[model samples]
Target: MKNNTYYRLTLLAVILSLSVTAATFGQGRQNRLTNSPREGYWVIESQPRQKSVALFYNDDNQLIYKEVLSKKRLNIKQAKTQESLKAVLEQALRQWAVSQKTGGNPIQNDQQWLAAELN
Candidate 1:
């Protein structure tokens, strides 16, 4: 009975450790786009391959502000480290915001829309 209890405890510990390790490395060191929402600040809604859709809510979820962003014009690449990719995304966002103010449609230019992404 003592030996059986010891083995069971050991097995549980090993399984737990393995799960933790796997969870830690699950992203696999890629510079993937993470849409970590900034609560009570601002939110960007990305629409892929479309002009505009009639949204139901179309408003911030009780947050500060919200805006629609076409992914066809922002951070449309996967060839950089996470930090650099974040910088590029920020620049693209700024450009998109500007375009919105000037009443210039974003979906016009389809090839690498953001100037920052071209750099």
Candidate 2:
């Protein structure tokens, strides 16, 4: 019984240590964009064919936050122009920041924002 408990405990510790190490290394190796068009506002982190991950920054270029934007999340039916897409992303980020300041309560319906953005 004693040997079984020790083995289980050792296994748990190893698993936990590996998880922490992976998380730390992953954060240290973030893939930041080198030539984002919206450099002043946000940096594109990852852009899959359909979805995009972005990291917003303040005026001093300090990382403010991150968000993932996709057509499904925004309820968009068609493709958006580049300028319009940037505007929508900026607006979503601002709304998210405000929501965070206000106790993380969702501010409005996502569909509402999408409709307003699309139009």
Could you say which candidate leads in lDDT? 2
Q: Who wins the TM-score comparison?
A: 1
Q: Residue 31, candidate 1: how far off, in angstroms? A: 9.8
RMSD (Cα, Å) for all candidates, in order, is 9.3, 14.3
1-119 in candidate 2: lDDT tens per residue?
99999999999999999999999887666632322334346455444457655555545575545555574233223447344445655665576568768877653433344335556
The weakest ten consecutive residues by lDDT in model 2 span 31-40
Residue-wise lDDT of candidate 1 within 4-115, one digit each (tens)?
A: 9999999999999999988778765332325421221222244657532111111244221123334333342454423333443454455455767997755222233232
TM-score of every candidate relative to the true structure: 0.34, 0.30
The lDDT values for all models are: 0.42, 0.55
